[model samples]
Target: MRERGFRLIRLLEYAGLLVVLIATLAAAGQEIALMYRQGRVTVADLLMLFIYLELLAMNGIYWRAGRLPVRMPLYIAIVAMARHLTLETPDMNAWTTLAEGGTVLLLSLAVLVVRYGHIRLPYRDEDPDNIGGRRS
Candidate 1:
């Protein structure tokens, strides 16, 4: 019974992920279409697209591995901070800009730490195929 319940939960997770994947794709398509109509792509627009790309990659990783890495969202946050800074610099005060930049720097450092930890103390039975990072 527990195994069946787990299967049901996993099925629901797949369904939810599928919805997110579709939404991400649709949003990306709309962004592209809007850019086409505008006839010009600003750095902000490119950054938005890159964020979408990262989301898709995150989703793909979760689907393939049944686990999400700690770094993907941090990377997204860093990109988002940069995008926010770029778009808001004209109106942002120096303090706010500095804070946002610092946020990005902190997130970058976090990624490095997580990566180092993974390398220096990897799972003893991590699966190279990314299948739940467990040995059979």
Candidate 2:
């Protein structure tokens, strides 16, 4: 029936997600090893590694719960922006640094907002009309 087909598609999607997560981790590990061997652990390198790890973790968490929380990626973005600013040379304009720094602050706020929602206002309704606590 259609239900079975839908389930099969979901299974396939989950499999693909797993593969993508594994590949990301593998690539991140390779990059980390290269950085280590080269005796270089710059801010940019660390940020890239952290982003990769966060993505892989997010994928795993989603696979388990059939949901992806918004906070993880927001935190990752904040870290990435910080790294971008840190790696920039002194000659970079003040405005550029301030813009990137402001972005990081916004991302941090987003993460905090999402976390507060999940913790302070846990979703309890299961009605289809209120899917994920949103009007459908």
Candidate 3:
């Protein structure tokens, strides 16, 4: 009975993942429509779209591999910061831009560190199903 319950849970998880993936696709389509309506695509808009794409890709990768790498979101963060700079170009007070850029740099370093740690210390026995994914 316990095994059957576990299987049922997995099935439910798969269903949920599918729904999310479909929503991601739908969102992408909406973004395209929005871009068309806007007449001109700015750097910030492009970066925002890139972030969305990365998020969808990450979700897919995690569903398949049971794990998500740190680098993907780090890349997204860098893009997001740049996007912010572009979006706020007219209103930027040097100090705020500096702070945001600094934060991006820090997150970039964190991505490198996380990559190194993962490579040096691969997933261990504590990993559920040995897939290097969420523990629960």
- Top-TM-score structure, candidate number: 1
The lDDT of model 2 is 0.80
How far residue 56's Cα lies from its native spot in candidate 2, in Å, is 2.2
Model 2 pairs in collision: none
| Model 3 bad stretches (over 4 Å) | 1-5, 125-136
- lDDT, candidate 1, 31-124, per-residue tens: 9999999999999999999999999999999999887899999999999999999899999999998899899999999999999999998755
lDDT at 101 for candidate 3? 83
Residues 23-136, model 3: lDDT tens digits: 878887888888899888777668878977887988888787765677887888888888888888679888998998898889889988998998998866443354545565
TM-scores for all candidates? Answer: 0.89, 0.79, 0.77
Candidate numbers sorted by TM-score from highest down: 1, 2, 3
lDDT of each: 0.91, 0.80, 0.80
Instruction: Name the 10 consecutive residues with the lowest summed lDDT in model 3.
Output: 125-134
Choose 1 or 3, whichever is better by lDDT.
Answer: 1
Model 2 scores worst on lDDT over the 10 consecutive residues at: 125-134
Residue 32 lDDT in candidate 1? 96
